[model samples]
Target chain A: MTRRRRRLYFIVSSLTMLGVATALALNAFRENLVFFHSPSEIAEKGIPAERRFRLGGIVEENSVAQGNDGVTISFRVTDTAASVPVRHRGLLPDLFREGQGVVADGSLDKDGTFIATEILAKHDETYMPPEVAAALKKAGRWQGE
Target chain B: MANWHRLANPTLFLEWSRRVRPWTGVATAALLATGVYLSLFVAPRDYQQGDAVRIMFVHVPSAWMALFAYAVMAVASAAGLIWKSPLAHLTAKAAAPIGASFTLLALATGALWGQPMWGTWWVWDARLTSVLILFFLYLGYIALWQAIDDHARAAKSAAILALVGVVNIPIIKFSVDWWNTLHQPASVLRMDGPSIHSSLLTPLLVMGAAFAGYFVVVLSIRLEREVLARQVRTLRRVQSRG
Candidate 1:
C-alpha cells in the first residue's frame, strides 16, 4: 500500500478502536449511572417503582426519627418546593443532619417513601457537591447554601 | 513504503503539520462552543437526575479522552519501536503529558462529582481504583520519558513500558462489570439501548464530540511544536559540525 493509504488506514483503525472502547465503557457502566432528582420532580412525575435512583436535597429540620430497631433511621428530605420521606438502615455519615444538603440512593416503595440503600451527607456547610449544586441552581432554588 | 521514511525528516513533518493545524483548531473551538451550550442550557435536566447531571458533560468526556490519549501514545510507541521512526517517537513523547493531564482532570472531576453524589470524596471501588491506576500509568510514562538523558534511549525504553501498560486499559474498563463496586455501570455506549433519556444523551454526545475535537487540535499543535524543536536541534548539530 502507498504511504498515504497506510496513514489513512492507521487513522481509521485507531478511531474505530476508540469508538469501540467508548461503547464498551459506557455499556459496562450503565447501571451505575444514577440520576439525581430533586424532591419536587420526584413528587410531580412520580418515581418509577423498581428503578434504583438518587434523591438530593436538605434534610428537613426536626424530621429525623430513629426507629425502634435503633439501626434504622427515617427522615424527610426536601428541596424547599417539596419533601420526600426517607428510611435508611445504617450509620449516617457525620455530615448528615436536618437542614443539611444530602443525597440518598435507593428505590421508592409502593407507598411512595424512599427506602435508601445508601445515604450521603451533603458536604460541609460552604460546600455543595457540584452535581447537587448544579441541580439546585437549574431548579432555581440554589441559594449557595 | 519507501516514502514513509520521508516523514522522519523533521522539516517535512513540520510542513505537513502547518497545513493541518489551523483547521483542527477551528473545528475544536466550534465543537466546544456548541457542546457547552447544549450541555449547560439546551439539554433538559434529567427527569430523574435534575441539573447535577450536568457534571457528566465534563466528567465523562475527560474520562474518554484520558483513555483515548493513552491508546494513542501506546500505538505511537509501538510504531516507533518497529520502524525506528523519530517522528513517531516525538509524537508519542508529545502525547504523554497531554494524556496525563486529561487523566488528572478526569480523576479530579470524578471526585468532585462523587463527593456530593456518593457521599464520599474517594472510594476503593473497582472502577475508581482502576482509573486511579491509569492516572499513575500516565505519570509513570511521562516520568520515564523525562528521566533518561539520551532522547533515543528514553524513547525506546518508554515505548516498551507503554506497550506493556496497555494491558491495564482493558482491566480498568472491565473492573466495574466484573466486580461489585460503588461506581455505576455503563449507560450510553451499551450493548442495549442507553438507559439515559434522549434529552440528556444529546448533550452528553455533543460534549463528547467536543472533547474529541479538542484532543485533535491540541495533538496537532503539540506535534507541530515538537517538529520545530526537532528542526532546531538538527540545525544546531549542523552548525556544530561546520
Candidate 2:
C-alpha cells in the first residue's frame, strides 16, 4: 500500500475512535452535562427537597406576586406539563417577566416551593422588530413572550 | 496531484495569495462598513431586549468566525500531516492567533451581552463552557508551536493537537441541544429557517461575510510572512555552513 493510503487510514480510524469515545463519555455523564432540570423532570423523578439543584422553565403568566417587603417575589415556573413555585429575594434580572424563560438555583422547601438564591433569565432563539412583534401579537400569531 | 503540488510550491502560493489579498482586504472593509451601518442604524429594536439585542450582530458573527477559523486550521493541519505540504503547515500556523483572537472576541462580547440579558456575565453551562474549551485549545495549539525548537516536530505535534481539538467544534455546536444551556440554542442555523426576522438576519449575514473576508485577508498576509520567514531561515543556515 502507498504511504499516502496508509496515512489516510490512520487518520480516518483515529478520528472515528475519538468521536465514538466522546459520544460515549458524553452519554455516560449526561446528567452532569445538563445545566438545569425542568419542573416535569424534577417532579417525575421526585427530587429530594434537600438536594440543591437548578429548576428551569418559563415564568408562568399571572403567577407572579410581590412579597410584603417588595424585596422578595414569588412566581411559578412551568413547562406546561408541570409547574414549580419559586420564591426569590432581592431584584430580578432586567429581562425577567411573565411568559419568559428562567432558571432558578436552590433547594425546594417542605411545601415544594423552590427557594432561589439566584435567578437567571434565558433568552429564546426568536428575534424581530418590536413593530413586527406587535403585529404578530395583534394577529394572534405570536408564539413567544 | 500535479495541480496540488504546483499550488503547494511556496513561490506560486505567494504569487496567487498576493494577487488575492488586496481584493479580500477591500471586501472586508466594504462588507464590515455596510454591516455595521445596517446593524446599528437600520435594524429595529427587539420587542423584549430593545437596544441590547444589537449586541448579537457583533457577538454572533465573532462566535461564528471563531468556529469557522478553527475548522480552517484543522483542515490545514490535516493536509500538512498527510501530504507534508509546507504551505499547509504555515497556513495552520498563520490561523492560530487569528482564531484565538476571534474566540476571545466572542467570549468578551458574549459576556457583555449576557450580563444584562442572562443576569450573569458567565456560566459553566454546556454551550458556554465548550466555547471556552475551544479558546483554551487554541491557546494550547499556539503554545505548542512556540515551545518546540524543531520546526518539523512542532508542526507535527500541532497538527495532531488540531485534529484532536476538532472534536470540540461539534460539541460546541450541539451543546445547547444535548443539554440545557442559558446561552440559547441555534438561531440562524436551524432546520426551520432562521428564527430572526429578515431585517435582523440580513445585517447578521453581512457581518458574518465581513468577518470571513477579514479572516481570509489576515490569513493570507500571515501565510505569506511564514513562507518568507522559512526561506530566510534556510538561507541563514546555508550561509552559516558555508
Which candidate has the highest lDDT of all? 2
lDDT of each: 0.75, 0.88
Work out the TM-score per prediction: 0.65, 0.91
User: A-chain TM-score in candidate 1?
Assistant: 0.65
Name the best candidate (by TM-score): 2
The residue-by-residue lDDT of candidate 2 on B83-200, one tens digit each, is 9887899999999999999999999999999999989998778887777777777877776676566799989998998998988899889988888888789999999889999989
The positional error of residue A118 in candidate 1, measured at the CA in angstroms, is 8.2
Clash totals, every prediction: 9, 0
Candidate 2 Cα misplacement greater than 4 A, ranges: A1-32, B1-4
Per-residue C-alpha lDDT of model 1 across residues B1-242, encoded as one tens digit per residue: 34676667767777877888788778878888988998888876543344666888898889888899999999999999998888888888888878878888888988887775556777555577667667766666666665565678988988987898798788767665676455666776567667565667777788888888888777877888887777788799899999
Q: What RMSD does each model have against the real structure?
A: 13.1, 6.7
Task: List interface RMSDs for the candidates, in order.
Answer: 13.4, 8.1
Clashing pairs in 2: none
